[model samples]
Target chain A: MHIAFDPRLRVAGPLQALDARCKVLAFFALVACAASVPAPSWRAPVAFLGAATLLLLVSRIPLGAALRRLLFLVPVVLALAAVVPFAKAAGGEKVALWTGGPMVPRQGLLVLWNVSSKALVGLLCAIILAGTTGVPRLLEAFERLCVPRVLVLTMSFIHRYAITMQEELARMKRARDARGWRGRWIWQAGTLGSMAGTLFLRSYERGERVWQAMLARGYRGKLIGPSSAPLRLLDVMFVVWMLAAGLAIRFLVR
Target chain B: MTAPAIRVSALTFRYPDGTRALDDVSLEVAPGERVALLGANGAGKSTLLLSLNGLCDPGGRVEIGGTPVGSRNLPEIRRRVGLVFQNPDDQLFCPTLFDDVAFGPRNLGLGEEEVQKRVHEALHRVDLATLEEKPSFHLSYGQKKRAALATVLSMQPEVLALDEPTSALHPRARREMIALLRTLSCALVVATHDLEMARELCPRAVVMARGRIVATGETSVVLADTKAMDEAELL
Candidate 1:
C-alpha cells in the first residue's frame, strides 16, 4: 500500500540525466527481449542480466536497494515454481535426490530455471528504470509516447495524493489509539471496517475538492500540455543501442 | 469607474442532499481590491468561492472581468479567477512542484519557455524555487501551502479566491503567507478566520451567515460591528 516517498532518490544522476522516454523505451525493449530469449541456453539470459547490472552501475543506484526490492518477489516466484521440480513433465528425465525419495523431473527443473531467469531479468530492468526516473518524468514520458491522457493523469494524481492519504490514515489511527478502549476480535473488525468507510468518504470529499481545483485552473476535460523538451541526442543513442542489443539477443544469439 | 474584477449577484446554491450552501449571495470586488470572506464553519464561505469560479452547478450570476461565468466562458473565467482551496493537496494535483506551479500557465496554452519562466517566477515569489523539481508530497505543510499559492499565482489571474490560506501553518509561516498575499496586485477574496490577516492584507470584508452575505464594508468597520459579528456568530 505504500512505496517510498523519498525525493532524494530522484535528484540528478547519470541515468536520471537521460530523457525519460529514452529510459522507458530502452528498459522496455530490454525486458521484452529478455523475456523472449530462447530457452536451453544461458548465453542470452546471462547477457540480459549483465546489461541490467550495467544499468544499475551507470545509474549509480544502490545495488542493495535494488536487491532488497527483488527480495520481496523471491517468495512469490518460489511459490509459483516450487512444484516444478517435483512434478513430472511429458518426455522428461528423472534424477534421484536420495535412495528412496521420489525422483525429480529434469524437464521441470529446466522449465523452472527458464522461468526464474527470465523473470529476474525483467524485474531487474524494471527496478533500474523505476529507480532512475521520477514519477513526474515517467508521466511526461507516457504522455509524449501518446499513451492515453486519462491514464497518465490518473497516475499523476494518485502519486501526488498518496502521501496525503497515508497521513490521513495515520491521523485516524492515532485518534483511535488515544481512546484507550480495549480491543477484542469483535471491536477490531467493526473498528477497522468503520475506519475504512470513513477513509472512503474522506477520500471522496477530497476528490470533489480536487476536481473543483482542477476546474478552477482551466482544466477542460483534458490535461494541459506536458511541455517536455524534445528527446536529446543522448536519448536517441541510448534507445538505439538498447534496441539493437535487444534485437541481437532475440535473433542473432541463437 | 471600470467594472468590478469579480461580480456576484443573487448567487444561490444548494447541495443535492437538500442543504442550502449559499442563499442569494451578492458581492463585488473592484480591480486590485482585497476582500475578506469571514464566516464560521458551514457558513458557506467555500461554497461561495466555488460559485465564483463557476464550479457550482448552474444557478448563479458570476462575472469575471465583465465576462459572465457560464459553460462556454468557464475556462476564461477560471483562468482569470484563481481559487486556492483550503487544502493544499486539493489545489496541487501535480506530482512535482514545478508541474503544480506551471499547471495554470500550461492550461492557458503558454509556450514551454513561457511556462518555465512563469513557474520560476511563481516559485521564487513563494521562495520555493530550490524545491521546484521536488515532488509536492515531499514538501512540508507550509511549503505545500506556499506551493499551492504558487499554483494559483502562475495563472496571473486578475482575481484570486483563497480558502483558509493560513489555516494549517505555523505563526511564522502564517506571517510569511500574509506578506506573500500582500505583494500580489490582483483583486483577492480570501475566505478565512485570520482577522489579523484580513486586517493586514484585505482592506474590505464581507461576512456570511446562513448562506447569505450578512455584512460588507471596510475591514476595520466590519470587524468593529459587534452586533453583526454577534449575529453571524463569528465571535
Candidate 2:
C-alpha cells in the first residue's frame, strides 16, 4: 500500500505538496470538464489540454515524459473510436489505402483526433494525480470526500494486498519455472485454473484471519477512523483556485 | 477474594468446522503478572487466547477482569482484554499508523481528544512516534509488530494477550520486543516457542498440549523440567 507501483508515471513535483483532497477534487473536476463536450469542439478540449499542460509546467514536472506516455495509449483510443469516422461517415468522400479493408474516410481522421485528444487529456490528469499522491493518502482523501466506507475500505485492502498477490503469483511462476513448465495458456489450462483456485482460497483464508484480528480490536462493524482535522488554508486555497480556473477556462473556451 | 486479571475455568472450544481446538482448559493470571503460554504447533494455544475475550465462543467460563465473556459483556471484555494476533499484517489493516493505533480507543467511544492522546502515548511507548503518518504496509516487519502492539496498548487493556509476538523477528528485534514487554504494566500472556524469551520477560509459565494444560508453574521451573518439556513437545 505504501509502495504505489501503479504502472503510471507520476512526476513528484510541486503538485505533490498540496493536500491529497485538493488534488482529488481538482483533477476529478478536470475529468468532468474534459468529458462534457457535446461534440468535437476544439475550444473546450484544447483549453483543457492547455490548462493541464500549464499545471504540469507550473508544478515543475517534466512535460515531455508525460506526453511520451500519451504515445502508448494513442493506438488504444484509435482502435476504439477510429471506426466511428469510417463506419458512420455520410460518405461524401473516401481515400484509398495501400493495404486496407475499408476505404479511409476524411471525416474519420478528424474524429480520431477528436476522440484521442479527449482520452489523452483524461488519462494524463489521472496519471498526474496517482503519480503524486500515495495510495494511503488517496484513500484518506476518499474518506474525507464522504465516499462510502465499504468502497473506501475495499480500495484500501486492494492497495494493501495487491503486492502480496503479486508476490504470490511470482512465487507460483518461479515454482513452475523450476519444474521446466513453460506454460501455454491453452496447453496448461488445468494447472493454471488450479493455481487460480489455490490463490483464491489463500486470499479468502487471509481475509478470515484479518477479520478475526479486527474483531479482537473491538471492531463493531462501524469503522472508527481518526477524526479528520479541518481543511487547512492551503487545501482550501488550492481547491478554490483550481475550480475557478477550470470553470473559467471552460466557459471562456465555450 | 480479588478477581484475577484473566480467568478461564473448564473452558472448551471447538471450531465451527468441527475441530476440537481446546478441551477443559483452566488457567488464571494474577494482576500485573507476566505469563508465558508455551506449546507446540496444533496445541490450541491460539484458540485458547481467542476464547479469552469471546472471539471464539467458549463452552465453559472465560472472564476478563471479573466480567464474563458473552455478547452482553463482550464490548467491556474486549476493551479490558487486548489480543494481538500472530501476524502484524492481520492486525494492521488501517491506512496509517495513527489510525491503526487509535482504532481501539475510538472503538471504546472515547472523545477525539482522548483518542489522539492515547494514540500518541501508545506510539511513544512503542518508540514509533515518528511513523504516525506512515502507511501500515510501508512499515518494516519489526516496526509493524511494534505498531500492532501499540494498537492494542492504546485501549489500556488490563490484560494483554500476545500470540507468538517474536515468531518472525530477528534476534535483535526479538530482544527489543522483550525489552518493550518488560516495561508494560498489564497482565501479559505471551504464547511463544522462545523459552529463553519466556524466561527473560515472564515470571510464570503455562504449557499446553493437545488442547489441555499439561503444566503450570514459575517460568524457570516449567522451562527447566526436561521430562515435562518433552511430554508437551515444546522442544
Candidate 3:
C-alpha cells in the first residue's frame, strides 16, 4: 500500500503559519466541544464542521487531499454507526423498512446522527491539524503543552519508522513473490506468517542499531525537542476565539 | 606526539549467545588521520566501531582522545566520536533532517543558537541545507545517507567511525560521498568492503578476521598483501 511518510502539505498559509501550540490547543478545544454537542443539536455540529472547513481553506490545503484523508475514517465510522439505526430504543418510535425487516427507531437514528456527525467533526479537526503542521513541529507543540517526553519520543519514532517498516514489509513481500511463491490458498498463509516473523526480527535488530546510533551521537536519556518560540499575540487571540466558540456552542445556540 | 583520536587495546566482546564479536582487538588512529577497517562480514569491524563510543559491552581499554570509554565519560566520549551506522535509516531517527542533525548538539545541552548553528553547518556540509524541513523517509537513499552523516557531523566529533559509508550509493553519489569525506579534517575509521573507497580516502587500513586483527599498515601496502586479504576473505 502506498502511504505518505508525512501528510502535511508543503504549502504555507495562514493556518499553517500559526504557532503549532496554539493550533493544537484550538483544535483540541473544537474537537472536545464537537464531541460534547448534545445528541439533538444540529446547529452546533454544523457550525463546528463549517469552522473546520474554513480552517482547511485558510490553510490552503487542497480540498481533494483533505477529502481523501477524511474519507479514510468515514467507512469505519459508518460501519460503527450502521448498527445504531437498526436498534430500537426504549419507548421510541420504530418504522419498518420492509415486511419483516428490522425496525428503525427514531431515537436510534438520532443516536447514529450524534455518533457519525461528532466523529466527522473530530476527524476533520484532526485532519486540519495534521495537514497544516509538520510532525516535528507537532511533536514540539505536544512537548510544549507538557506532554511526557517519553510519550513524545515514542510518537516521534513511530512517525519516523512506520513508513520504513512498511517499506521493509513490502520488500519482504516482493522477495517472497520473486521466489515463485504465490499462495492463493488458505494453507499458503503460513508463508506470510513466517514473513511477518522475519520482519519482526529485522525490526528488532534495527531497533538495537538505532539505539546504538542514538547513543553514539551523545543521546543521553533525555530526548531533546526543537526550540519553542514564545506564543504571539495572534496565536493567543486565535486560541481565545476558538475556546469561546467551543464554549458558546456548548452553552448557547440551543 | 599528539594523542590518538581513538585508542583500543585488548578489547574483546562476546554476545549473550556465546558468540565472540571482537577478541583482543588493539588499534589506534592518530589525530586527523583516516583509516579503513576492512574485513568480510562477521569480521567484527562494526563491533569494534561500536566499542569506540562505548556502545558495545566490551572488555578491555578503549579511549577517545585520552578519555576512557566508560559509563562515567560516555557522554563526552560519544561527543568525541561520531559513528555513522551502516544503515542510514538506523541513524536518522528524528522527525526531520533538521531535528536529526540537531539531535546531537541538543543532547550536549548546547543553547538553541549554537544548536541551530551546528545543524545548519552540518546540513550545509552534506549539501542538504535546503531540506532541513524534509522528513528522512521522503529523501532518496543517497540523501538519507548524507543526512545520517549530517546527524553525526552536527556533533563536531573529533573522530568519525562510519560503517559502509559508500555501500549502497550510486556511482555519482559514491563520488560525492568520497568528495565530502575528503573535506573533513577529523580522524576517520571507516569500516567497509569498498576497497576503492579505502584506497581513495584512507591512508591506512586495518583488516580483521574472526574477531581478530589480521593486518594493519599503509593503505596501499596492506591492500596489496594478497595473503592477508585472502585470509580475511576480502580478496
Candidate 4:
C-alpha cells in the first residue's frame, strides 16, 4: 500500500525553506494561469512548463521522481488526445492533410495539442508544490489562507489515516483470499459488497474511539493551533517573482 | 491524608443498545499508588477508565482530584485524569509525533513556548525525540504505543489511566515499558490481563467479573487465590 508520490521530501532545498503559505499561494496562482492559457496558443503553455521545470530543479526534486508522478495523469491525457484527432472527421469537415493513410484534420490536431500541453503544465505545477511541502505544513497553510475549517480538517484526517485505512482494506482482502474464495465469477461480488460494509463499520467505530480519545485529552469545542511566524523577506520575494512571471506569460507571451 | 487520585462509588453505565457495560462499580486509587485492574474481556475495565474522565455517560459518583465528574467540570477532570486507549492508532491521530504529543498541551491553553517545552520533554522521556517529525504510520507498533503515552504525558495529569499498555508488545518492549512506568510519580490505574506485569508493577490488584468487583487485595495474595481466580476467569 505504499504510494510512490510521497509529498513530504526529506531533503533540504530553497523551496523547502520558504514559508509554506507563500509556496501554496504561488504554486496555485501559477496553476490557475496555466489552466486558462488559450487553446490555440502554444507559447504560454510551453513557457509555463519550462518555468515549472525550473522550479522543480530549484526545489531539489529529482527529474525522474517528478516524471514518475505524471504516471497517474499522463495516461488519461493521452487517451483523450488520441481520440481528438478523429472529431473533425466525424463532424464531416474536410481534412487538410493525410498522415500515412488516415485523414488528420488541422482543427483536431490543434485541439489535441491544446489539451495535452495545458494538462501537462498544470500537472507539473501541482507536482512541484506537493513534492516540496510536508502535508502538516500544507494543511496549516490552507487553514491560515482561509480555506473552510471543515474542508481543512477533513483533509488533515485523510492525510493522517488514509494509509491506515488502506492497510485495513488490504488485510481484509488477504483474509478473503485465505478463505479459498477465488472470486472468479460476477456472482461472487457479494463477498466484496459485504467486505465493504464491514470496512465501513470498522471505520465508523474507529472514528468514535478517536473522538473519545480527543475528549479524554481535554479537547474543547475549538482546536487551538500554534501561531505561525511572520513571512520572511525571501518568502515574499519568491512569491512576488512567481506572480510576476505568471502575469508576464499571461499578458506578454501572446 | 491527601485526597485520593480517583474515587468512584456505585457507578453504573449502559450502552445505547441497553447493554450494561458497568454496574455498581466502586474503587479508589491513592496518590502515587499503582493499582492493576485485572479482568477478562467484557468485565468493564475499559468502561471504568472511560468514566474516570467523564468520556461516557455513567450514573453515580466519580471524582478526580476531588472534583466531581460532570459536564460542567469535564475539561478540568480530563486535564487531571489522562486516559490512554487500548489501541494506539485511535489515540495517535495527528499527522506527526510532535503534533500528536503537542495536542493535549495545546488543548490545555498553554502558550506556544510552554507547549513546545512540554512536547520536547514528553518525547524525550519516551525516548522518541529523534522521531518527532516522522508520521505516526511510519512508527512501529511499540513506538506508536509509547507515542500514545507521550500524548497524554504532555498534559501533566495527576493520575494516569492506561488500558492494556503491555498488550501485544514484545518482551523487550514490555520490559522497557515497565521500567519506564516505574519512573512515574503520579498515581496509575493500569487495566491489563498480564498477571506477571501486574505482579511486578502493582502492589494492589482488583479483579472484576460481569461488571462487578469479585476480588480485591494485595497483588500476590489475590493472584495466588485459586478459587477467586477461577471464579473471575483470570486463570
Number of the top candidate by DockQ? 3
For residues B118-206, write the lDDT of model 2, one tens digit per residue.
Answer: 99999999999999977677799999999999999999999999999998899999999999999999999998888999999998999
Better of 2 and 3 by TM-score: 3
Q: What's the CA RMSD for each of the models? A: 2.9, 4.2, 2.8, 3.1
List each candidate's DockQ score.
Answer: 0.69, 0.55, 0.71, 0.67
Candidates sorted on lDDT, descending: 3, 4, 1, 2
Report the TM-score measured on chain A for model 1.
0.81
For residues A113-174, write the lDDT of model 2, one tens digit per residue: 66776787787776577667757567778887899999988986676466556556777878
lDDT of 3 by residue, A1-254 (tens): 11224544557788877899999999998889888887867677777778777877887877887787777777877786677776656677887758898778877777777778788888778777877887767877888889998998898777656665776788898898898888989999999899889988887777777778888888776677766778899999989999998888777867
Model 3 chain A weakest 10-residue run by lDDT: A1-10
| lDDT (10s digit) by residue, model 4, range A41-62 | 8778778888988888887877
Candidate 1's error at A138, in angstroms?
2.0
Q: Proportion of native contacts found in each model?
A: 0.84, 0.78, 0.82, 0.86
Candidate 2 matches the true fold with a TM-score of 0.81
For residues B124-186, what per-residue lDDT tens digits would candidate 4 score against the true structure?
A: 999999999887878999999999999999999899999999999999999999999989999
Runs of candidate 1 with Cα error greater than 4 angstroms are A1-5, A39-43, A86-91, A96-102, A174-190, A221-226, A252-254
Prediction 4: B-chain TM-score: 0.98
Off by over 4 Å in 3: A1-8, A86-88, A95-103, A176-188
* CA lDDT, candidate 4, residue B23: 86
Prediction 2 global C-alpha lDDT: 0.81
